[model samples]
Target: MDPHNRRRHPTTTRLPYSLGCHACRRMKVKVLYPRPHYRHSLIGSRQCDEEKPQCVRCTKGGRMCPGYRDANQVVFRSVNTEFIPEAQNSHLRKTSKSGGLLIESISSTPLLTQPTERWEAKAIGHFLYNYSLAPTKDSPGYLGFLSDLLSKEPSNRQLKSGVLAAGYASLANITGLSHLKRSAEKHYGETLQSISMALTDPAEASSDTSLTAIILLQMYEVCYLREMWQSFHNDHSQAISDITLVPQDPHDKGLVELHRLRGNSPSRTAAADGILHIIHGRLHFNSVGGLHPSRIDAELAFEGLNISSSQDELWCIMREMSESCGKIRAIMSDPRRNMPESAIIQSFDRIFAAYLHLLRWEATQSLTRSYQSYKMFSREENDTHQETFPYKYHLFKHIAHGAMWIGFWCTTIYALQTLTRTSSLLDVQLLSRGWHQWDFNKRLRDAIGEICACVPYMMGDVDQLGLPMVGKEGKAIGSFFLLRGLYVAICVEELTDLQSSYILKTLLRIAHVRGIKLALRPRSRWFAQHGIAT
Candidate 1:
């Protein structure tokens, strides 16, 4: 009988030759079989293009296409891997006809031996690695409290689920991973359910974990949820209606309570303090000074924290300005109530006082003063008419300095707009001569210009500047700071139709790019009112 024609024993018969080159075969060899993408697999219809140097599949998949091996030298051999213990178990061993070992390749992609861990741990780690804003231990980022809280109460279901939701959502947003995105939505739903349960229990409702979970839910909605923008728009309209038409008491949860609930770490405490001030000053427009006992306490608090002096002064000024604005809003809301002219005059006096303080602060700041001079002297007639942001890109060496300048300009615009409205309410004879000295229109234009110039720096668009100014990792932090100032600039009645269009466009970019839904609220309203497509 011919040796070729003789039937071989079933156990000793060699498999048919693969279409793939040796390198492609070697990269994906498995005892069970090559996965579907490899050539001549029982499970797949794919076949490799046997190119001279290497197969097409390996090259296209970003795998190094090592040249084919000599068929004569082909031999079975054991290949060791640094895969995790579980992965090692998942792999199988097969004996060749020559009694040599055939080792399977676990994967074509290079991977470190990452241990199998809980999905919660992975999710939490992913979220912090990307979203943490804290540049240093001393100055905790906005999401720093999440770390502290999780460390203390690792099993808090509500907080854990919230963190998981945010982590998965952010990762999905960045990588476009459908499974992770679905996981995010699933965790978000679980978190909402957990929070609902927590709210019903009296002890859990006011817990820090619950509060932090609530904060995370807010952040998740702002960063991940697509429908949140429309929801925010609906709520914003209702909010406006409540503020302007209703006579509800100013919402104050009390500073004592906030101080009590503040986090343990300095970073957490500092973040909580800043948040307290922002909620009081911007959200409710309540007076921070009124809540505190004396000027010394506020000053001491500012000094103890990593806050900038310029911001400290500006906040002091803004607290008063916001209070004045709130009072004016309240008065305007109640046309039926007999509000005396003296009360209205008092509010105007406070506004004027804040305006003067703002001017003095600007003059005293070397950085702000130089920037102002540059913007004032650098513009050409053509540039002024073009409705573009004035001045070159100025780098902020310090976050505090950036905040200080942005806050100053924001406060200045608010003051000017307030004065314009207040002047209309007051008799012309009663208007202060000093209010007339500064051209409110020119001042607004200048302030808006300066604020616009700060956008790129704040957004980390100029990473070429070499400052760690809120890069991709700290987008939430940057967006948090940008929202209030940008909204204030956009809302100025003195803004030109051209300027309004430009600023609204900027807000739209921030909403979509930064993934901050709060931005959409103002942008949608502005665009709707202006008859522009949002």
Candidate 2:
């Protein structure tokens, strides 16, 4: 099959349906438009371009101007620079008010491009910029033109995704504890605005929007929680002087999760919940310091799980899941989770479905259905108005196998704040090219395997043009799977202080050859940390 034909297939939206193939999947591809090269448009020189792009602003005063001129040529030449200004394609010129020669808008948003698989590296840049770095105004798709390309009368030549997603990611990337705190606050407002939009869309709204809104709200909640803890820390300097640390039990099986995933049964001997047990036992960073008494209440109440673990530098390989009831597991029930990705992406759709039910005074019924683990007993009272969905909505089964992939990305972002450059973090599994250690590489491969496995489900037939699962409803199924791959690749490539950048770059090269959507959120949380307020 011709690689180009695969780009427009509908099956691309859902994960694999029946068989799994070892294929290099694509996430996004960016095509940088060439400059007009007309004397006046000289932006700046390459050396001065990293902090400032060579745009009209930099070239305002010409040769005698203080800053270097001819800067916008780009610090690196990676995209297809060949210009095809042939007469037939001239319409693109009129759209941009130039000779069909328009510069891509500079927004901090990471926009995915067609044949997305090609630009895997950019995705990593986005992950690092959005989650690891401090916030800056331009840190997130600071290019500024990304969001404008997503409407009814979308830009004829504009290329990118909406501002919110990319912008939100950027705010997460900013560095510095103090600076990060402020970026979170400012972004909280933007997220609040998105929330407001979801609240009003009675028919236009679906499970995806509502859930994402709630998650964003939670992001704010987390920031507030951190602020509260920081305040407490400032007020109680000597409260933890006598903290007693405990050691994890070497023999504890009942403490394990109610049911182990995939394998293991009641009779199977299991490893003690050592991770949890040890975490609970430790009282201080160093044994000499002992443990703080204030944390004891928090610790015991946590039932062996530590709050610090939430902040633990996230590693790709997990022996067992953190309380199955936490975030990712909690989100699997989202109505949008069942919805197709092509329909419209609602990163928090699961949460939205739950919120809508809550709004109608049916919080239990709503949240119950949306909760993946919410198991209710069959009762005669089941016959209620609860079964009905507004004319615009339908009960859709959210994809499962695909979600594990998404879980990985969400997990990565959440972990970035935790794993520091010096922590005993093992990020080698993040390698995109391939790792050689049998066990470690196996872990990474398993994650990628799940992602590629879902491709058939999203797009359906490798031969079909329209993805059957997506249908005319505007939803695509496998999006979560692909995003997961992008998320992990991005983190491994750029976010984590991983030493092997080349592996991810190579994986992206494979994506380009295979033809997948390669995209990045240009404006990330980093800029918010660097330039904006919380």
Candidate 3:
């Protein structure tokens, strides 16, 4: 048979019809019969060339030939004759919709797929549990609104990712564990990636979920990273601007209220409607005799108030003052806003009156008595007394004192800034005139002392109160109180350079121990601006 001369046949075809040869019959194929070359073979041989339907010799021998099998028929070979049972093989079978067989191996499953989800759940769980504790007295609505966001379904991926990142970051702080810290970093990267994708879709970018995610990411930076705080600050400022352009939603009302109450610039629509309108309308550009009407009203509202005063009422007053101070600071810092001399004087007087109001409120017998009582409580409890007296009681007492201290400190700073911004002769003369014989230095020293008192209570070191030892707390301090205390310490003028440096360093150390990144930004700013060495 010539190899090149063998024609390719269709897969369905077989050799031409021929009588079966014994070999071809057994093989189920047509036998080839070619004319024998007498010179290439023995004349008596019965074997034909077997190249086609029948060889001439086969015909001469009167033998039948078998047909060839089609090309498409395929045979599979097994390595071993002992086959696995179908029951066992069922595990490898993937059922097809058409009732056909499909096979997949168990090894194809990814090893980390399940663990990744578990890690994500863990991080999210940590966030849900601790996020409520993050806000201060001034922003009580923060956690509530965040909780509301989390309750809704088809959860926002960006927001969830951001929360996970923050949660892991907080866990890193709580435990100081390296793996948790790495997880925080990993989730943070994921959050950024998600946010970047969300931003590409204008609708998603402006969604409430996106805004909340942005806020959470900022919070994470504020909690764990000192160096990133400024960047978060800048990013938040930009987000505030961007949020204004987004279409308003009813659900966003809480956010709007929070922004207004926190003294941040609220959306114009929010500012013009509801209780916000009433508050803004009442406070805007309204003053009398160098005092804000609201401040005067706040004072008058609390006339004859004592230590028995409703804690809620006192808190509300303090919050108002805080907001007012924030507004004043914002206005003073704005280069584009020019105020008339009369307005400036009024601003100065308003701040001065606010400070005085805080002092008067504090001077009440009830307040003084409460302060004394807290001091005694803190003093009575030492590290050894932990079994009998829980640290929470002491923490609560410290927080109460811290709240008052913060109120007074903020009011005083606002007054000081008012004077600094104006630097007017009237402002100078008003203070020099010795109105009620007020001593600014003494007042600042008293405020610093009050703040310093909180340290021992927080550190479980009440026994060393009168001693000059710097103590670290055995447990985490409330970030809110720590931040407020830091703010007061930084802004007050009475502390000597050495005293200020020590306080700042101790505060930073406590913050680090507690995983409090929020205070670091302002604290760092204070050091840089004042050229305070730490």
Candidate 4:
């Protein structure tokens, strides 16, 4: 019964054979039984019975059997020869009579194939389609720069793993696939490990590939990980801080060099800045109750860029907003630190300037403005949207224009809120003399109305005018943008009770439909108008 010294046996039954068990294959031990017509006979192979549980030979010899490889391991190519690019196919033999080639799929050799699993492929594909760069630069989701870098450095395991992790995590959120979620967590852990290992080496850690991987991991966190968001945010900020503080050789740019490594496209650079700012702008302010250090870095990053498009202008407004916020936070937090009314007035003036800029900016985009218009439904015309979407319904030329418009209104409201906060510190008569001409309350209400008007369009629901809404390729991208604006609108004190309730309801619908779990849990302040606390 010794497996190492098996004797040959003769069998007449023409039972088909397969590849051997792990142990047998490793030891070069084959089935002692003979089959003259075996598939692998040309390679002088012996038969593997591949019995259930453990194979008979391994059991008889007290050897542990890992079992045979699954049938999936050995794939057969179709005899019908349709040529495809980058595909492995069988050899062809030319026929003398017809001059046609015949596929020789009868060979025993296995062709090399893509090693990724089916779910992994699906997750990666979904992530790329939504986030990758569009043909035009105006597209909202602009993570395509990561793909460009990935193409160049195919050997960067950490970057690739992080991309897959983000993909898997995002797909899992959308589909509620338990196995995909588990796989996402697995890849996420591996990505973190890879990043950790890479971080130990200064050159590798500062490389563009490494930074891209970290940013991808951050995307996974922002989209899905609610509980870990704060902790991870702090850790990520600290990591960047540590890297930035590293003493650079006089000849080396260090932090500046790391920024340069982000790639050549301004939109790519701006996208990265916008993402970081969003993570900081949204989460950190809630958790830490102050301006995040990374927000400062984002602003500094913005300073280096030249504005070429509306997308760049949007980032510029955001940068200006962040700067205003920092000044207000500093002034309000420390009354004794300075005694300059002019400085405080200047902060207020800057905010109003940014507000004016946003207004002018939108006004100047005549084409985008023409395509995007709003209609307020009357009581007689109101139907189901009467309660769910009682506000205006917006129409757009392109999804990008709609997003920009929503972003504009959201920034307008943000500016109004910031101005109010800043105005509280100074004497009302001092600034209100000139600024009071602009109906701040009406402006606030109008901005909120515009955001509400656009939600149905953004969410792919039909407008009040009976026009079909365009569903963009990445619903998640639209969801994120709407969530940001709506979250702000619902909390505005100027919003009516009915409007606030409708916005909350829309937020809930987005959570269920878009699968962004964060949307489900609104902050306690969001429900104040309903007299309900979190």
Candidate 5:
């Protein structure tokens, strides 16, 4: 048996031995999509190369897309991988194996240009590792036949492209093999350690190490989010002292304009002066305070700031209220969860107001104008001309971030407002009024409506919102986010200390049973639009 036929792992594709197989040329199919020219479409196609686009199968099928089954008839085979150094050692090791970049490589040859079967094999390994829909395997088939047939000397470079492809595959939620997470993490960590050097000497990072870092980073993020939710309940007790909050730079959230109206920073004042005079032609309540009151409406950006300021103030007030009643925060009293449902709803109402203000500010800045959800990036990733929405949901981030921010922000506001007064620590306000009067959910719904109205227009649908798209879909999803905000408000505030601690776990159990979870690469971006049925 040829040692070349032995596989590190048995997959589906096999490599070539001894530079043989004349019909390997016949099997070498150049797969182009609707367009005959593959090179031209590489740069022009708005959809990602990975995304199933309008290929010949779909073009011929008419109106319907080619499903995964149709992918089989697509007819393509990647080359052998594994022994990268042997191929790179020679000029013949140039072409790539699978995926769009593989297609791309054919047009642009590598620095070395002895186009031989070795290069084809190693390139195939890189492609299968990076972009193969299935995990790379050992076979004459696309899955695993390569390691068995292709014979070459050992090369670390061969693994470079392949490892990165593996990362992309994993991140996109396709397991080349049913890899154990902990084992994958451990093995992947070695890749991370080696890749750390790449940060200092980035050029040394071939596609392999760079991709490993990205995947590792993604894993870290996923783990971190999960831990955050687990630990978020106890967050109400986690305090941010007045001294801790570094007076935030306005640009931190990319917030604009209000600092100038208030005349806080010298640099901001300078920028404001020009923007007022040149951009809006109005400069009254700012440095030059003699512009007509009638001209106040002229500066759209400033008006947005004014509204945003009010919202912030509202959030500050609500945060204080939630802190006072939160099961985690109300620990001064025993059993720790004496607050009623009404109080929680009231807190939510104010928080909802704050969220509305944030959205307005975002809209004014043109941040949330076109974005739909972070989960779904535009098909035209390179199209810089497009304007996507900035994701700032009803004044919150992940549940834990929201909790910490509210806690942190409210604590600061409380300290700032009460600097002169001292005895107000235990003071509780019993509102005779009801949550219905405020009805902040309605306000949140409207804000969502405005954001949704912009999505279709961004998606190139200029007509009003409609079903299956954004109009009805938008309302349903928008209301869903609004509901979630309310639910979090409920979760954070309506609990005993015991309840707060287990609140997340309990919700997870319920959600698990009800199947109200986002899929593998979960995101909150679509949460609002889809109402958790996402």
Candidate 6:
């Protein structure tokens, strides 16, 4: 038999050898396999010129030529035959052809997969690794507490599910992945169901895991609301009620205290020592001084502060200024009698004096010292900022600056609002003389500018600044500052339409990017009213 015929059998088929172009083999089809326009110099074919635009043969044949593949292109093929690399094949024992090539000889053994619980544990472990220290010292630190609850024997399923939900929600925000958000929603639903069921059993309902789970559920809701606009339902009220039934641990007591504070009901001791005394002092001053006190001890104390004072003294001045604001508000809101122009002017002078004092105190402090103190405190508080991630320090520093900025902001606003109301009650010419000296417009602009400066810091981007290592506390604090600033900026009549819109949009972007639900609702409302898409 001929050599080619000997290689063929009844079970196999052979095609006649033809020197075709590489494109034919790549396409692996018989019909028009060697396309008409394909440039190929077959052994028996005519040697046609391969020209750009179109080959000579293709042009003569009136066929469109498809482009050719690159010379260095690599194609991969699949085969059932065993052909291990020489470096790896040396370990195999020599054997008969059938035995050596058998699929079983080179096949890998099936891996024993871990159970679902182990996999869940692994995922939970990963989440804790990232978020275990996320909460600040002042916060409840529910994530850290959840880590402990997950590590316990038998495990708290409700709490674990809540943690998983919150973890995935946080991850979704960080990564901006839809699948993780969906996963978070699923686990959140499961957590709610579990908590409802657990509530039936008294022992289970009052457990720390149950309480932590409730807090985590709240966090999950916050994350969910950040991405979408929804009505502000008080989900936390029900949780607060449920918390009353729980046995009082330190965490539980703290929750109860927070619940009371948020509910506008101060603890009896705090009321006695703090707010009640302040109210009493304000009332006493009003009764004696006839709507405007000639001498307020708080205001006098602030006026006496020297430039060479410590932060503690400056803080005292701030407190005095804050109290003076409350007194001014009380005087303005008094329904008993109308305030005289003389009294209003006197009150304005006192408040304005305190405001100037604060400004002077702020000026005396070094920006470098403030920045350094902020960095040092932040590094001490958050572990995420240690070595691997240093930029997070700026975010925390921004938050610290926010706290100070808010103080200046509130005082400036109070002074302006009080002055506006007082001016409305008096002859414009009479008050204009006093107001012109203060430059209220300039003061308001400066305050708004300071708040705006905080925007880049809060958003975790300032020139070549580091990425934010923002955790729950940072987000909450930053959102609060921005929201307050937005409110202040929106209320200012001095701002032009374009200026207000710019501030509003920038705030909206920060809220959206940071997943701040509280900031989102008001921002979305403003956007809707102004014909801007959220």
TM-score preference between candidates 1 and 2, better one: 1
Error of 5 at 132 (Å): 16
Instruction: Kindly give the stretch of ten consecutive residues in candidate 6 with the minimal lDDT sum.
Output: 285-294
Please give the CA lDDT of all the candidate structures.
0.58, 0.28, 0.49, 0.59, 0.30, 0.49
Model 2 C-alpha RMSD vs. true structure (Å) is: 27.0
Number of clashes recorded per candidate? 0, 125, 17, 0, 46, 0
- The sequence of per-residue lDDT tens digits that candidate 6 reaches over residues 67-145 is 4443223221212122233213434444567656523244352223334444344436545554333334322221444
List where candidate 4 sits over 4 angstroms from the true fold.
Answer: 1-116, 137-141, 146-155, 227-257, 260-307, 333-346, 368-371, 381-390, 396-400, 422-438, 462-474, 521-534
By lDDT, the better pick of 1 and 2 is 1
Candidate 1: residue 267 Cα off by (Å) = 14
Per-residue lDDT for 1-534 in model 5, tens only?
Answer: 789977655233233421212222234423322334555565444322223444433344354443332222222433324223344433354444554232222323243433334333333443333221211121111122223222221344323333433333333232323332333345445555655555455344423224323433432332222222232234422311211222322221111232233433334322233222222211211111001011122223333221223334433444333333232223323554564655544544443444344345445533322232323244476777734332221222122222222322222222222211211221232133233322333432333333322222222222232223334211111121222322322212212333222323323422232222221112222222233422
TM-score for each of the candidates: 0.61, 0.21, 0.47, 0.61, 0.26, 0.45
- Supply candidate 5's per-residue lDDT for 462: 28
lDDT of 2 by residue, 240-323 (tens): 221112232212211222112112223321122222322232221111111111112222323323222221312102211122
Predicted candidate 4 versus true structure: per-residue lDDT over 393-481, tens digit per residue: 77765455566566667667767766766666665753555655246777787888887877766776754354664563335656666
Candidate 6 global CA lDDT score: 0.49
For residues 169-200, write the lDDT of model 1, one tens digit per residue. 76675566687778889989999899789767
Top model by lDDT, which number?
4
The lDDT of model 3 is 0.49
RMSD of each: 13.9, 27.0, 24.0, 15.5, 21.5, 22.7
Q: Compared to the true structure, candidate 5 yields what TM-score?
A: 0.26
